[model samples]
Target chain A: MTGVSGGAGAPRLLQVAGLSAGYSGEDVVHDVSLHVDEGEAVTVIGSNGAGKSTLFRAIMSLVTPSSGTVTFDGNDVTTTATHRITRMGLAYVPAERHLFGDMSVAENLLLGSYPRRPDPERLAMVYDVFPRLAERRNQHARTMSGGEQQMLAVGRALMSKPKLLMLDEPTTGLSPLLATEAYRALAELKAGGLTIVVAEQQVPLALELAQRGYVLENGRFTLEGTTDELADDPEVQRAYLGVA
Target chain B: MISALMDGVVLGLQYGLLGVGLTLIYGLAGVINLAHGQVAVMGAIVVSLAMEADVPAVPAILIGLAAAAVFMLLVDATLMRAVYRQEGESRILLGLLIMLGVGFVIDGVLEWRYPIQQLGLRIGGEPIPILGVPMSTGSLLATAVTVVIGLVLVVFFRSTALGRGVRSVIQDEQGAMLVGIDPARVRTFVFGLSGLLAALVAVTRAMTGPVGVSSTISFTILALIVAVVGGLGSVSGAFAAGVLLGVVDRLSSFYIGTYVTTIILLLCAAITIVARPAGLFGRSH
Candidate 1:
């Protein structure tokens, strides 16, 4: 909440207040609240099953929130349909990376601009970001390696030119080097003025990319601070930073 | 021998068309529409009544197709609303039961009201010889129409934005939504298209023989088998399976008997399912 104000004049781009969402009418993430201002990079660091995915799903309306509200770019989107929310400039890349397995890489990227024709500049930008996608444009997405598929997922999200991009555990299966490379790309996107919210188990990489972060433990945010503060916190170091 | 093979190819094209309609709807909506063939019969009844009222052949066929399309759109918006609300197995089962009831109602009404009504399109012309077999004008026309429509559908699913959106929904529903493609809209559109394709198959079938109320169940069975063999969601697969099954149907009928041909066809579908559960083109999850 400290960085909810994007400077003095930049309005808050995304705000979630008291959101409690889960599957089967039972709440997994309870009364969670967070906000990311325009052009800011925010991270939610948590262990497995910490409800990070649930929170993001709640924001996207993939799962109905038992209570609370999500406001994006000044609109109440608590009950908005998932596709409608995406159309309103909030793109999400889930941990599963649900790419169309049978379709080619080019088709997957092309579909990212749904209802709107693919913009040449945006397509070029995505290909520039992940050149492997360009090389395998005609190859089926199912055939791509795990790291390549992750790249395609992020590339697809970027194709929409969204105002705020949310990702859940983007480094779930990547090698250490590839995970670092993935963050490097994200860092470049942040440098290019993109607003991002990433939920990650990898605290070091996430802290490096995000300016501020919230530590989520078992469905609630237990701590909130700038990246520097989070990196130095004793609990965060012991639990996530691997610092004895 | 050549004649039977050629006729089989012609019939196979129509089967391909029918399966594609059914396959697409199942892929997108997760519903196996039991009322599909009955709805097609309803459209044929519309065409027959339109022709009785002095409407020309082509316009009457167009009106019938539109009627079927509109009827399906209505069903998708209204009756299928409850079905769409459910998830996974319940969704599919509920849709099946609802559509079955709709089918029974349509069958009862059509049989009671128009017991003898049938659509028979007779294309009067010389039998054109091709590849050593003389082909009837009606068969040729049906084949031509089916081929053109098939090619159009392939291009649509392969190239067009709306078509790709439909495919995207079938492939990964959540991913489709994240990309701003509404699964509901895609389902509705595909439902209407399914109805139209079903009616189109009826019209094409009428070229060879009369399509009456009795043809409804058989049409549904054929569509189901073809769709299953075609992998349930692949358009090109439907056509390929249709063609292969069509040849089998004709050859079996000629060499053995019409009674046994159906059993053999059923066997083919069963074997396809047992051997390759995903059908020929469906990707295994």
Candidate 2:
């Protein structure tokens, strides 16, 4: 079988086309399309209530798309169950970080490899990425501080050694210092050749970590370019970079 | 008094087993199985019928447990399919009504056809002394089995990957899904396990006294009290509540009238709900 690896003209690792999804017959995310290539980091930058979460949810099959298609690693998976999509190497860490609160940090990480035995090497790698998780391995996820919990969420997702990692607002409740620290870890993961698609209100951090970026405004991609090009755009600068 | 206390302990273990099934189902599915006791009785009756047909006790008990498990799996696949489709309050309400209806149907059938069917296991041996109280061989054996099963459950939940997957679904279903664990599959498995557990309790209880079709309602009531007092969905909590309530049951029956024991137990449940809605060992839902 031909894999999704890219040399030239190969299928992208993930492709979403004409996706419009919402709740109760009301469209929250209008017709939107995006793609991520193998071993590349891409970011979708948008503001609050801009339907970023809705787009991610649709891609994960958590929210049924009213009309659209999602192809992942050469398979059309628009209507697959969330768990099946997850097992297909798409790991998502949402803004709210739907963590198993009653479970210990270690337990949560262990369950990241659900229906499969957790590899010790992956566990150690997560511990290396977030040493705080290593320290509080026995502590319940609910008891950890916001930064620590975020770290745990990311670490837990990494436990699967997923082919693609998508995180929505990973720095939601962290202090500025912790936010940068979280980004630093993401940078490290990207450098290690993990494919990443992160949706963020923290545009500068996301742009710095990603090679290319998409500007999602009002539930549509208003602009898409290399990080350098988008960073130079005055509209992007004024709106997302807090520059006048 | 010592003998009563010993009997209470034995009775409490059985109660804990009974409640564990109901609580596990509720914890994972957000649906209380009101037909839990009826299913347990159905298992007991199956065993009795097999024994009446000259089947050996061991094989008959195994067949009874399998019958109950299969029945629950069928229910999960059929009526529960609709119930699981509903979410939040509607789901809980629908599940309750359907299970209650199932309970009525099973109870009606059992009483209509097997009015005289009862399971009474006779373990011939001298009474064993525990804590200076003479305990019947059946009670001692049942207690041993319950304790062993309890330990196995604890280990399974704590150490096994599939078992932890069950707890993950209970803790946060969305999170479980993201981790590639299907909540629907987990619910179905737990529901079947609950049925097997319910049947197992019936088998153990028969060693002590006759388990008759008429005892269905009482078993259901006892299980409800145990689940409430222990905190629904908490295994350790259920066992803790069982022991405490069992002792209370015996002490009240000894000191007060036997007719009022159920009322007193119900009162304890009421007090628990009023004081701690999450239960003694449960997280607030």
Candidate 3:
């Protein structure tokens, strides 16, 4: 169990205790426990196939946990449906960036705000975050470049005005500049007091923007500390940062 | 010629209504409902029975539509639910076979109970002359109803949240799930709506001309042709193709012979498949 306190008396916004999730009766995520307090940005950094995505999916209720309890904002949500979990102010931006290719960018953004009324202010905020999206609001999402689509995916998740936003591999295929821009957006969101949980293979960027992070290997948390501590850890450097 | 053209337009609209339901179901649920025409027949049977029992035209039609919708909901819940759980070719093949059996059962039951040769609505009014062509009150009313239903569907898909949710499912099922749209609920709603549209077609047929129990197969074939010609999932494409085929059918039957009309329709469908396999308006996947 890794307890990164939010503040002196801040309430815990999310708590996962003994979560064991899997596919086809075989456990992949084994007895993982973690917590995120209010106004915190946490990252789970791992290599490919380390089960980081599965952990996030379990948290979003997209995948059923074989055994565990997930408490979000003081309510048990381990067995809840994915949409219900989303409606409860937790938004997930999946890795595939599953934008309705035929639908316009504006329509995709509008769908993000589906759990609540479509607010013009939210739309404006999303556009403000990604000015290129504003320029191509009426364009089909499929026609956009990879970087723009990533931006759109992040912006779409933000439209829901969720208390906790979980993004899976937000900068996976972006150019160096675009990845920086994405991290900049995340930093901006974190600065705005939005709690975020990001699962990423991009170790340095994830560590840089997140206040605290967990190093995950084989579906288990290997190390947990503040970003500075993890960056300074010799084991993390040899494996993730390519430093010996 | 003008009267034939006008009649063709009306018939085209009816075909569009009939095909739209099938298109939507296929587009969203990926299920080809072989029971579609039989469901319409069931609705027609209800209307006919209600009329025989002294029910008024409006109420009888409404009752029939509701019954068809309810029946489809049952079909979706009981049969299609299992079909959807399967994957790939198995899903398609199983859906076809199951719905085919369902259609046959419905047809057999209706034949056994009703035993009626033909049924027609008893709409009372004088023929109205338009551009020197006399159009019956019933035909005009059916056309008007078709147009209204089409408009309502357009608005529903464009403006309503539920409708948007359905579209989202159509585009990407997993993505829709992530955004909190339940695909199962959307599927059920679409299946029910499809049945309601078929029921509307039955009522329109009863109003404009006699609808025999044996005509279910013909109606299904016609609707399938329209859907394919228009592009299976595009509503506007289906409507346009229905109108085009209806006009072509009427013109060919008049100029050549009734036998040649079927040949021409088949040729149109074949050409469309060869040229644009996705149908006229369907996005090429």
Candidate 4:
């Protein structure tokens, strides 16, 4: 509909206000409000089951929110279906992720743009970012290492030319060195001005990668500020960062 | 013997076409789809009913195929969807029960309306004079349809965006959704296509059956067995298994008897299942 670089001049690509949601008839997310401004890297940090994943699912519309509203690309998409929202230029990466394990890596990435026509330029862009993907393009994604698979997941999302990319955890279960490398790629994307919302258990890595961060505990936002504020705060350090 | 082999080859082609849809359903939705046969049976019923009402054969069969497709969509919405998202054999068994119920209702309706009877729709060649061979034109038509459908499915899955989207949905529903493809809509489209294909194949087989709803159950079960033994998700496997079963069944009928033929084929299928577990070409879930 619009230009390929969808985030250009777009204001507040994703906005979630008072987003309370969960499974059918069972609410887990409570009064969670967050925003991913166009081209701004944001992170939501919390322990497992703190409703971090639920918030992402709610934004993705996998789980319907009973209250509050979600606005994407300046449109009221509170009740929109998951696909329609995604079509609006938001790509979500879940925890278990879908890598088309039996399919070749090229096939997996090729499928990411199924909603739109094939674009050689887009494929080149993804390949350029993740060279490992280009080298193993013919191999099955399942055969790749954890870090490579994560690259595949992110690369696949990028194939859609998304305005906003929401990743649940880009570095979980990765080796320390691999995790650092993953953070570098994520930081590079942030520097390139791709609006992102990443939720992770690895606090120091996430804060280092994200400019603005929210400290979420039990489905509620407790602290919100520049990454430097949270990194230096002893309360956040003891609670999340595990600093001595 | 050559004629029999040729005839068997033609028959096998038909089974391959029918099995493709069955295999796709099992592989993607993880539903056993007991109602799969009812869709085929209904196609024959539609053709017979249309002909009785003065509609031409081709148009009538097309209409029948469309109706079967729609019916499949209905069954998916009402029966298949609930179980597909559930856990284990629970979903499979639930879909089986619902489809079984639908089959019974269709049978009772057909029995009451058409009365049990047999009518044949002949196509292609007349028994070649002096050849002493009875090559069914119907079988030839069946082969042609199967080939076309197979090629079309291949192109669709491999070349088209919509087809890739369907496959993507099957591989990872959640992942596909993130990229703007809804798994539910994909499932509906696939199931509807399956219904249309199964129904078309059923019309080709109508000559030996009472085209009323009563025949739906047996035919659906036959397609299911062929599909399962071939492997649920692989269309090529379904096609191969279906033809393999069809030829063997036809040959056995000549050597033994018609009633004993199905039993022997079933035994072969059971043995295959026991041996491969994932059918012939299917990988694990």
Candidate 5:
């Protein structure tokens, strides 16, 4: 929360080049590359089985890359595993929105400081952004509503003091209002200059929150463009916005 | 006989500690640590070695704890790390097989250094009079140490960031990770902590129990039963189950013959599993 934001000349927060990775037997992501600059919000929109989640997993090092390099904050992290990446100030919050349901919301949030414990100021900053979390911090995360859990997941990531926050389909299970709130929170994060990446299925909403969007089909970059241009594209209209 | 009851209580306390450690490790790592008993033996051997070398008794015990922690940490880092986030009875079996390797390895090494000879290093001080019992200095030290460790573990699970981190992982590893807590590290520490607990049991067991034979393996089996009986990973459950087993072990041995004691305890454990699949003191997942 009270992080010393990186310098302006700092390298791109996340850079994935020629990254190909997937499960042990099957090659899910085929030589796909992506990047998110400092203070940038990028979203990857894809249909089911389109490799959106797989890309996130590969970048996070949960899934081993078949080949290619992933650099974060100017470090060659192509082979680094998930926790190593997290400690490097890159936090990945999954869409399944895994929050330690059995743990109190506050306890779950506190865990974000494990790698860098004894840092209370950062934790206090997370609470500052989400006042509701501070209010219900003592309550178990599982008992909270779907939207609250999503918020908690984001807050927990912030506790890591990540320069970049990557969320996988955070709004998939949320209500319309909750989804909007999620967008608002992410925007607030952008205003505060935290680089972000969101892998989403909601095309228009994803475009609205992010400055640029990437369309993924069958694990390849089917289309990439600015928010305005994609919104106006006929294919985008047909495949995503569902308009004539 | 009063002697029979006392012996049972002493044995039961040791079982309780082993059970707590085993259940905690199992809950967090989902693997059966067959080396729990051997770790205990290693602790006792370390302590005895330290004592024989004129190391202070208190430091000797602490060193044993540290040894257990470090050894278990290695086991998790090297062996158990790959098996994280997978849940199945087979995983448990695999864990047992792995520990089988660890057990033989540790026992083989320990046997070389410390022959299985009973060496009771009595505390230098005189035996303090307690409730009309003719207890020696060593017994008092062992009892006090066990009780203190039990209390510390309780506070740890409920209070410290380390303990809470552990609880969060147990509840949901993936969720815990989203918040930046690495389940892998927690599992390593928990497994090591289990080893430390085994060491504590070893110290007391060495002070008062059979020696020469590979007694660590036998006690691990007992500890596993107590852990399962107490319920997997329940803090209160481990302590409660340990005490109950201790009492049951004593009473049954006194009423029945020593030969039948094992049978009675096994029956009790089986009935408990049938009656409450979770445990007497724990809730099943």
Candidate 6:
């Protein structure tokens, strides 16, 4: 795991302080606070109902934070629109994948660069990351397998050249081998200095890819530590790592 | 029979233009603008009045088109804004009711001011002979305009970034928003486009034949039928279905009777709904 050198002076890419958000009037995420420094890979590991997704949504401004300040690159963006937040270099990939099923894979990737002219070099980089996507570029997104679709979703986000990429439950329905493949791709991306905030139920993979981990339970972060520390923690192993 | 078929093809093209706007609105915003027909009537009436006031044909048509686009944009900004955040069945129902009320208001004003008058454009040149049939010059001009508009729209959706954004919204609003496309702005632009298409339909209809104030209801019904039969959100489907229905309507009216045309069109719509609820080219939700 990469050491947390950002400690006090390193520039924070995203800072969320006291964020509370939910659907309708019910709060799903309560007073959650976290920060990701530039080039750091952070993971929020939790169960299905632990509000990990909500926390990510709140940070992306997909869900309005009831009371909080989300500072991105020293600018307060708690109340900014989702698209504006995306334009400011924060990209989010939801659990559903949300690929336009009827559209071609290329079209879906191109749409990620919306409100901005698509750069061929960036597109080439996405293609280089996921060679399977390049093979099926002309095919409809619906035709791809689950693993391929997930890759396409990630590739599409990369098209925007986002500085920080937030992913929700990326390995939810994947087989072990496919899940490993996805995590390896993400690990490669992290090595390239892309700051990542991944919310996942897959504890081992998330911990393996992220330098730091946060254990969330019932809309709040129950524990936070370096990946090695959390992996060694008894409670985390018993609950998430499935250690008997 | 050949002439009837040709006439149907021309009318189908016009109906396709009309249905594209409604389909786009439904696809992107999930709203059915019930006042769509009335808006077209408003445009035709404006053109008629303008021509009566000695405005040239080109200028009058342009003015009417502009008026319709502006009016619909205003409607979207003020009235539709109330239901912009709504979703699913409630949003559709609310939009339908609100636009229906708008339609009634517009109809009332038009009737009071214009009376039960029939207005049409005059074709300057002689009718062209094609395949032993005489085609009115005005119909040919209207058909040409319809083709041009349709091509332009195709290019817009295929090539332009804004058009791609609109398509993204239609496919998945949440996904589009995640990528930083404003769904609200896209909806507003779609509403304006819908109005422009409606105005084009009005101009074409007026050129081909006379349009009365009460004709708005028929136009709305026909446009809805065409849109649904083509598949609600598919523009190409709308165009195909429009042309098919147009040909059917003309042929059936020539053989069966004028009164039976509406019944036949409705029956075709019913069949389309029963066989493929998503329309011919629509992706089934």
Q: Pick the candidate with the highest DockQ.
A: 1
CAPRI grade of model 6: high
Candidates' lDDT values, in order? 0.93, 0.90, 0.86, 0.79, 0.78, 0.88
Isolated chain B TM-score per model: 0.98, 0.98, 0.96, 0.89, 0.88, 0.97
TM-score of candidate 1 chain A against the true chain A: 0.98
After superposition, candidate 1 runs with Cα above 4 Å error = A1-8
- The fraction of correct interface contacts reproduced by each prediction comes to 0.93, 0.93, 0.58, 0.82, 0.62, 0.80
Name the better of 1 and 5 by TM-score. Answer: 1
Instruction: Give per-residue CA lDDT, model 2, range B1-285, as digits (tens).
Output: 988788888999889889899888999998889999999989999999999999999999999999999999999999998998999999999999999999999999998999889998888999988899888899988899899999999999999998999988888889999999999889889988988888889889999998878888888888889999999888888999888888889888998868988999899999999998878998775
Top candidate by TM-score:
1
Model 6 / residue B88 / CA error / Å: 2.1
> In model 4, how large is the Cα lDDT of residue A63?
88
Q: Please rank every candidate by DockQ, starting with the best.
A: 1, 2, 6, 3, 4, 5
Q: What ranking of all candidate models by TM-score puts the best one first? A: 1, 2, 6, 3, 4, 5
Per-candidate TM-scores read 0.98, 0.98, 0.94, 0.89, 0.85, 0.97
lDDT accuracy of residue A120 in candidate 2: 96
Q: List the residue pairs that clash in candidate 4.
A: B12-B243, B16-B239, B37-B220, B120-B207
For model 1 chain B, give the 10-residue run with minimal summed lDDT: B276-285
Candidate 1: residue A160 lDDT (0-100):
91
- DockQ of every predicted complex: 0.91, 0.88, 0.66, 0.62, 0.44, 0.80
* Residues B1-285, model 4: lDDT tens digits: 666566667767777777777777876787776767766876777777787789988888888899989988987787676777787788778767877787777667667876653335766466432256665566556666778878898899877878877777767777777778888888899989999988877876663233445556666767877887888777778878877887887788777878887688778778988888788877765
Question: 2 or 4: which has the higher TM-score?
Answer: 2
Worst 10 contiguous positions by lDDT, candidate 3 chain B: B114-123
lDDT of 4 at A14: 78
Q: RMSD, model 4, all Cα superposed? A: 4.3
Docking class of 1: high
Residue pairs in clash, model 1: none
Q: What local lDDT score does residue A53 receive in model 1, on the 0 to 100 scale?
A: 96
lDDT for each residue of candidate 6 in B171-240, tens digit (9 for 90 to 100):
8888888888999899899999899899889888888788878789888888899999999988889999
4 or 5, greater by TM-score: 4
Lowest-lDDT window of 10 residues in candidate 6 chain B?
B115-124
